[model samples]
Target: MANTWNTDNAGVSALASGDFDGDGHDDLALGECREIADENIDDPCGPEEFAKGGGIHVHYGNATPGSFGYRQQTLNQDTVGVAGVAETGDRFGAALAVADIDNDGRDDLIAGAPGEAIGTRAGAGAATLLFGGPTGLVDAWGEGHSVGYQQDTPRVPGVAEAADAFGAAVATGDYNHDGKADVAIGSPGENAGSGGVWLLPRASVNGSSAFTPAKLGLPSPSSALAYGRYLSSQ
Candidate 1:
């Protein structure tokens, strides 16, 4: 028999409802991903950034107030588009998180991706960042590709790829004072292309729900991706 039971968010996706706004009524803090991409692999590029990897359709779900994965939808134009990060070019978008890392009283999200990467698309490729706006979650930042220092360095959202990516993230704290939450991305490897993580502090960020796609300027090896969970649990 196949094992199928997970109490924690690890190894599985979930959602719930609560007062993320700290308001009397409940709010929405959800995790969305391309659990299933409804469209065909148009193959934006000949070789394609996802050329070698298996194509993964986009899958996304929404939360009910404080509930994570409370409500999900798998339809084109239903929600945000590809994070645009090169790493995630090949049908990526599965990892996701929703927590109040910034402590803005309202809940926020942190996306994770291991396979998300861009091919040699140059300017045509960029990174991806979708922020929550007056409407809902929307593709709000970065293009969809990593270049120069950003490449080999998955830590930063700039020039990084949220595509075909995988890994994990944990809430640290609101390093900034933007009434939002903060999070850190991981790239379990070593220095010099070994991979790294990105630190996203909350900002007064508002508008089309776009993020600048930044990298945490931590010391070299900001901290390996494998042992990143220590901060999330503690």
Candidate 2:
């Protein structure tokens, strides 16, 4: 059987799959990282609108073979369940990670918007966590739906600088051996271009509280190291 899925504006820049609905069938998340200015005329985004941002789409699975059906959800900064306002250059779905972060027997989602700017700190980057609910992934920001997190030099305890490009990469694992999964966010533009990574504990994430992450970096004095450019859990 041949199954195909499609989205507008050359979507599907990134892809990840898991049992997002807890129904035994796997679901897919597609990252549409570029927003087209005009679909009718195919107009390109102007310099001022470079930060118009993009979005992610979740396709729920069905019992039918090779079918996701029409049950789907769209997510972005502007989405009802998402936290924070959608801003230009956020690239909300640039990178994705899925796992049972809360030990709820349901898969959760993590999306990296490495282009997201914080205050005057352009490209400071951000990430969003969407928890799965009884029916499936919560479609909007609410009591149990979504939370946004970011890495800053002050709170994350690392090299201080702007345009750090945090959230450029993400990974989850039991870094503390606590049985619960933890997240590691990579900032490839930190330390005057040396890069760094921050580890967020599972407890902190589950509690939905502010946390001071443990930063990691290389021992060398090399510039432009980009240590956390990519990450994975063993």
Relative to the true structure, how large is the alpha-carbon lDDT of every model? Answer: 0.32, 0.65
TM-score of each: 0.42, 0.77
Native RMSD of candidate 2 (Å): 6.2
Relative to the true structure, candidate 2 reaches a TM of 0.77
Model 2 lDDT, residue 225, Cα: 77
Q: For candidate 2, lDDT tens digit of each residue in 110-186?
A: 77787888887788887788888766665434333787777543344443346777777777777777777787777
Query: Largest TM-score belongs to which candidate?
Result: 2
Q: Provide the lowest-lDDT 10-residue window in model 2.
A: 42-51
Clashes of each: 64, 5
Give candidate 1's error at residue 92 in angstroms: 4.4
- The root-mean-square deviation over C-alpha atoms between each candidate and the true structure, in angstroms, is 10.9, 6.2
